[model samples]
Target: MGSQSIESGPIPACELMPASILISWHPPTTADVTVETVPPEVVEGENVLLLINSLPKNIVALAWYKGVHNMSHVLALYSLKYDISVTGLAHSGRETMYRNGSLLIQNFTRKDNGFYTLRTINSRGEYVSKTTTHVQVYTTLWMCEHPSISGKLTVESVPPSVAEGASVMLLVHHLPPNLLGFSWYRGVFLSEVREVSRYTMPLNLSMRAPAHSGRETLYSNGSLLLQNVTWKDIGFYTLQTLTTDLKNEVLHVQLEVETSFSTCCNSLTSAPVMIERVPRNVAVGGSILLLVHNAPDLQTFSWYKSMEKIDKFKIAEYSRAMNSMTWGPEQTRRQKVYTNGSMLLQDVTEKDAGFYTLQTLSRDLKIEVTRVQLHVYKPVRNPFIQATSNIVAVQSSVVITCFSQDTGISVHWFFNNQTLQLTKSMKLSPTKCRLTIDPVRREDAGDYQCEASNPISSKKSMPLSLIVLAF
Candidate 1:
């Protein structure tokens, strides 16, 4: 093997030569010239060293060529008198030479595979020596056989909502073992999905101006923790992961950042007023009523979406004189107002998730009555549990694994209708995918259940009864 070349331009000779003509070619008739045998194989992207076995001590010049027939096929040339080395344009970045009658080629690509010839001339010009060697370079096995991706990828944000200047953590789950690296992007909502900032995993310490630069830490488990998060950090974040199997997956998470100081009617409300309870969880195409409470004397009521600041935008309103409901231009299509100061939202969607405020007048003063938080999620699926051995002898080991089609979820195990507690005999994997019981006993016998849950919903698996035999 030889040193890798660092030059890049005009392609190398091996790349230009057709595979059909890379065969052995006779060298010029010179009885004194000796050529060394070619190596068996050279992996692509490795260095190659071509040696001109024996030559006179005082060498006037040395030339390394890709083809034996022409000077135009020269790969590198050296001038001993001037002590200068000029590499071929095609091999500029990756080729170098030794003081001795040898040539060093770095990162030998398949395009570098073929016959290489070296020529040396003594200062006296009395004798000239030339050697020809055949070089074979093969592509790396992994590159030749690109694997397909066969796993899932997900990202979870711990404490999805936070006040400005608070810390937040984003956790990644279900990353494949063959993963190469992952990248994170803070989405900028322009006309499209523009990225305001980005962060790459495996932490490039030298990178400047990265989104998470200086303020974020990446854990070995692929989690990112942001310290002192600000309103600038609010928006959708995307995580893109690539694996060695040539597979890739992208996940998105929305982050809501609130102000540290409140400007709304928090101080004005002397007592905790219960209006109507807002249903936070709703399925697609479902109906939800933002119930109004304790406002029997109000002449009129108005609903608004609380903006980031203290200001609000009216979405719907009710008039007591007309005994009718009126919606804003944008809300009339999806939202219906009731005479009781309540709002009915139909065909709920993920877009409906946010904070809403209801406002009304009390003694000529605008008073903010209640705030509602809404979330729309897809219906949860039913998951099931599987055990390696349902019936086992005392003192035997058993493994229980939970299975779910969902990507991001939390697994909870239960024994005899009670939440199972971790003990000396119980161990769970980091992702909670599997539970292991090292030694089973009579106490281990029960109705085992596994529940998989996420922020959206929870699904319980059918109980699998376990039996234990006496020792």
Candidate 2:
């Protein structure tokens, strides 16, 4: 082969190294945005501003959400740059956005209650800052347009019928939050209204009515305590709340104050006052003394057996003016009336297990000196226990029953001289008259007894020995 002409296609061009290019990027700075509210609380039908402070410069976008999570549930969105737009379902005619990215809400309602979150984007289009605020809306109780949905606000006394000279508490329930102020009123009826007390929470001020005389004290939760109540306090009480939302919520309560001579008659020195008796318990054939203290001289006394308000059993009636004691047609000689206000019974039977009312009037019988309720009771007797089996094998179930001849007796169980408590493995009847144990074990072997008790007396049954066989 001829010497080939060395024609390398073109001198192999030297491949020059491409110049290395370096680029620098800066991490975005977090926008420490602070959120604040004008009143700190949002009320219905009120204007509120959610202020945004310390926002980063050159903000590209800002958005708000109803809840804490901003990724979902977007409430409002704004774009400052290209599209320059506002979009959100809550964007009613009343909502307005300020130049500084603050949100203004107007005519809010209960539906606006929740945590509101804010999200901001930096100029570089990076998700940068976030803040949250809680908003609450309250509605007035007088706006009963939706009674079933919004529970009615009410003020009620623990005991609707309270004795005079006693302390009574007025409890307010179902009250709305975000209250501007609250007031109390007392009147004979709904039409007549008189202020009793007023409290302004925001200002930390409290005012009492002219007639209050410091007897009415208000609690932080809007409850009122009336001290040393008298018959004059008996009336309908109303609770009024002046909410920031510009609505008034009112709750009403009716109080009945009774003049109890025993408890309220401190000024009656000459009246034959009645006293409370320690509950009396007498055997079937035993006698009991029902006596009154501080009875005036020579005041006639009357005794009545009150099983029910209607059809009372009149035991006896005595008149000092007549100087004679008369007995009811059904009253027997077993009862005797004394000069003082006291009744003596020779024998008490189950039929006598009821409240006895003592009625004493002034000498002219124009005014009742005192009225009291005397309770008499018969003791429970003949309590016995019956076991399904005195001896039982392991993993077997055992049942024990308690019985008493007296009705309305509660039965209590004891094991190894210790009171027995109901557990998952043990069950008791509704009346606690029966006890059942499942999966008997050797550890369960012990002496068991039962006791029957009533308000009057208690009786225990003999101890029954239980034997458990191990498998």
Candidate 3:
């Protein structure tokens, strides 16, 4: 076999093998096509000077495949490359001066995969091979150091129930070999760092939003460790090896939380209080019901709205027929008898607006202070509308809002007694419900009102007369 010297190029950093590059080629029909290679393993993000040497006259156009096929032969789009003088089938320069083709790749991604088959089809039918390399970038910049389970994982103290407050500490790792750390994210963004030497697992010691709590694990070497075990701690944790793109192993840890310290404080032993839900004011057509929760067992619950005590049997009958019975919620107008535990005011008009009390008779137990609020709203008159400017120019915007006294209601907006369009500028926010006309003109002045409604009844604010100003 005849051959010529090829130029050597620089190497990439993310590649393994330290200093050895893998090169392969096939023989073409002509013996004149002799090929040689210089530097094979080029450092990623660096420039490469590929020297493809061939017989004086056999240098053909350059062809480059950004990525080469591995044993499995999955075509990775990320594994593509570029060549400077790439034409259909022509060479830039020929023969004597070994063509110095500048093979530079930029902004490499994991998909930039690799390069190979740097060939020169020489005149003598014998092709020459320069250098080929397999390139892969770490998907993650960091890894876990002794990644362990978070503490909020619960058990039966319930084999598995997410705890109210707990966090798992994980040691993060950043290395060339442990670059794949997708597990830490679990397809979601993590609040922790990715590639640190150590990290604490997720922990939510605060029980503010318990339902939002979740589980995850940290893994290194072969073991999956868990931390802050709760009854919810009993579950399967998979240790996925990014190098293999599959689950290498799984860990099952069981943990539980016992009945923590008990005290008369916040415990059931405290004389429980009974509080009811009743609006202080109702519109011309509205209703109200009394509700008392967290009541101590057998504590006689009494309902008194405007000084009248409710009857117990009436509440029982109400319960039997209610779509769903709740402390005699079934009591209808026909039953007419209000129960001591519950009382319902139907089709409430302005006359029915007043303070309703849920009197608790832990009278025998008498140790806890129990009280709640009932603010009913009865519109003294139809809502009146107001605006900053009645004749605002077409290009100017205006704000319209509703105001009312304690109607015991969180209102939603309505147009012509139907649901109004909810948009960024026209909808109600937590602090205030407002309506804004992006550009008001003479035509926009009209009747508008805010209706506040709740589970029981609805009320509408007085209509505001709007008058738009035209420029």
Candidate with best lDDT: 2
lDDT of each: 0.61, 0.63, 0.36
lDDT of 2 by residue, 1-471 (tens): 011111221211111101110011223355356566654434478888888756777666676767864344545555554323344554445556654668888887777766777766655445566666666554442111123432556676766568878989998766668788888787422232367788888988887775565788987678899988886575557788877888987666656576544444445564345443333445667777776655665457667775222234777778887888877644767887787777777676767655566667655554443333333456867565656556566887777766555654567899989998666778886557767889776778898888878666898888878878675
Those runs of model 3 whose alpha carbons end farther than 4 Å from true positions after fitting are 1-381, 414-418, 422-430, 441-446, 453-457, 465-471
Best by TM-score: 1
Poorly placed runs, candidate 1 (over 4 Å): 1-150, 163-166, 174-183, 189-214, 220-222, 230-232, 240-251, 258-280, 288-345, 349-378, 381-386, 401-409, 429-433, 454-463
* Weakest 10 consecutive residues of candidate 3 by summed lDDT: 71-80
Residues 334-373, candidate 1: write the lDDT tens digits.
Answer: 8877766778888888777666667765434546455556
* Candidate 3: tens digits of C-alpha lDDT, residues 98-123: 23433434443444543433433332
Instruction: Report how far off residue 436 is in candidate 2 (Å).
Output: 1.4
Better of 2 and 3 by TM-score: 2
TM-score of 2: 0.41
* Collision pairs in model 2: none
C-alpha RMSD (angstroms) for model 1? 21.7
